[model samples]
Target: MSWLVTGGAGYIGAHVARAFIEQGIDTVVVDDLSTGRKAFVHPEARFVQATILDGERLVEAMRQFDVTGVVHLAGFKYAGVSVERPLLTYQQNVTGTVSLLGAMEGAGVHHMVFSSSAAVYGTPDVDLVTEDTPKHPESPYGESKLIGEWLIADQGRAHGLAHTSLRYFNVVGSGTPDIHDVSPHNLFPLVFDALLGGRTPRINGDDYPTPDGTCVRDYIHVADLADAHVVAARRLEAGDRLEPVYNLGSGDGVSVGEIMSAIADGTGIAFTPEIAPRRAGDPARIVASGELAARDLDWRMRHGLGDMVASAWAARKAAAPAAE
Candidate 1:
């Protein structure tokens, strides 16, 4: 059966697309290239350059590809920018998802896997969040994602769609030399740029209540995250009736200082960082239990923080010359 991947040319989506290709699955990627790169799209998979907002085009693509399942990963995902452009975020994340679901329904594709984020927890009372955690999103980005998850859940019940929502936190690492983070908003790429440019990296906050007084996040390698998607897809294919929410993370927290230390060790670049006030709406710590994913999907993270940083550093160095 063929699978349709939305935003499959983007960062995480590209990696997941690679996983599907390696499995010999017939895959079709639909991306508008708004933020995705055509270079990241594999030659093995059919690529369609179109926006999901175009419901007719999306439905036509699904039918043309004979799509049996969909992995929804397209949307705007900048937390800070989402705050300033709330309506835009809602339109892309919420409205875009609705459009995709409609297309899927029309094509009779009932299985879906969504790329969600930990931002939905919004500084949960507990340090480690689970799939059942009450969502109290702090930013428009988070709110939009939460709404997407709710839409998937409600649609699944109302229309007999089987779906899974994987909530990820701090997705890092590189899958291949050619595919790297070109996004300006993510933390790892920003730090990589500063170090490669011989400039000091800036730490947003240094007074969070953590051990290092900095914000702590669970960093999961992108390859491992991609593997989790494969497993989730297999489970869906196996006809497992389950809830649609699962948290994918390392189940351990690493502070900003700790990440910088790993980057220094990985890149062998010794540069001090400037401490700045915390950005608005950043949570002190966000660690996921990941127990549900491990138990249900039989998934476990293989790479640690050091591996994540080292791989990212190598990819960053390779991209630097062209980035100039």
Candidate 2:
């Protein structure tokens, strides 16, 4: 049996698909290629280009591939833009999840690993966020993710569908040079774009209460994040119980200034970032404790900040030619 990965062609989803392939897990990728790239899909896996909203198609694909589980990652993920497009965010994230779950039921697929977000804990007041942290999502995107988790849990309780949700923070770096983050909103791509275009990177705000006068956020490697998903999926497939939700994060925090410094050093381009005024609702610091995930999912920070920077830079540079 294979696992169906919705949005498997995406930045993080591609990494997840790659991890599954490496672990000798048969994979089936279904993507509409909205923000995802077809080039990122691995050749060993079966690919079906269709939106998750199409329940009939999903059921057919799952049955065709003998899918036993699902790794659901398809969604609209821009928190800032989600404010302007709440309807679209909910339709894609919440509605799409419902459609996927229905299709899974139709195909008798009972396992799922949902792709959740740290945005669910928007500007958390605590020093280190945990699974028990109070959820105060500030945008439609975050709200949609929380609602998705609720739907999954409700489905599990009613239908015996085993599942878990993974709340990811700032995921960076690359497992392969061929696959790098292409999101315009992400820090790595934003900085890489600025440098590649011969412009200085801009920091959103540098007057925050953080030690470095900039916002501090937990940054986890995309590869490590993918591994955790695989572990969770494996456990679910094995009928092993898991926490309903887990934060896939690095307990340590890194400031925006430190990230710029690392980028400069990694790319060998020395320039100070232009400081922009603070955006409304921006937090000074937001990190998480991965202790629970470490105990259950074998979660570990295999790559440090230096490794994150260097690998991301290498991947960005490798993609520069094609981008031009």
Best by TM-score: 2
lDDT by residue (tens digit), candidate 2, 1-324: 999899999999999999999999999999999999999999998999999999999999999999999999999989999999999999999999999999999999999999999999977889999999999999999999999999999999999999999998999999999899999899999999999999989998888888889999999999999999999999999999999999987898899999999999988999999999998888899999999899999999999999999999998899999875
lDDT per residue, candidate 1, 1-324, as tens digits?
788889999989999999888888889999999999998998999999999898999999989989999999999989888989999899989999999999999989999999999889888988788888889898999999999998999998899889999999888899888788888988899998887777899999999899999998888899889888887887797898656788886788789999988888898988778999898767788898988889887668888888899888787778889875
Displacement of residue 6 (Cα, Å) in model 1 is 0.4
Candidate 2 whole-model C-alpha lDDT, 0 to 1: 0.94
| CA lDDT, every model vs. true structure | 0.89, 0.94
List the candidates' TM-scores in order. Answer: 0.97, 0.99
| Candidate 1 runs further than 4 Å off | none
| Candidate 2: segments with Cα more than 4 A from true spot | none
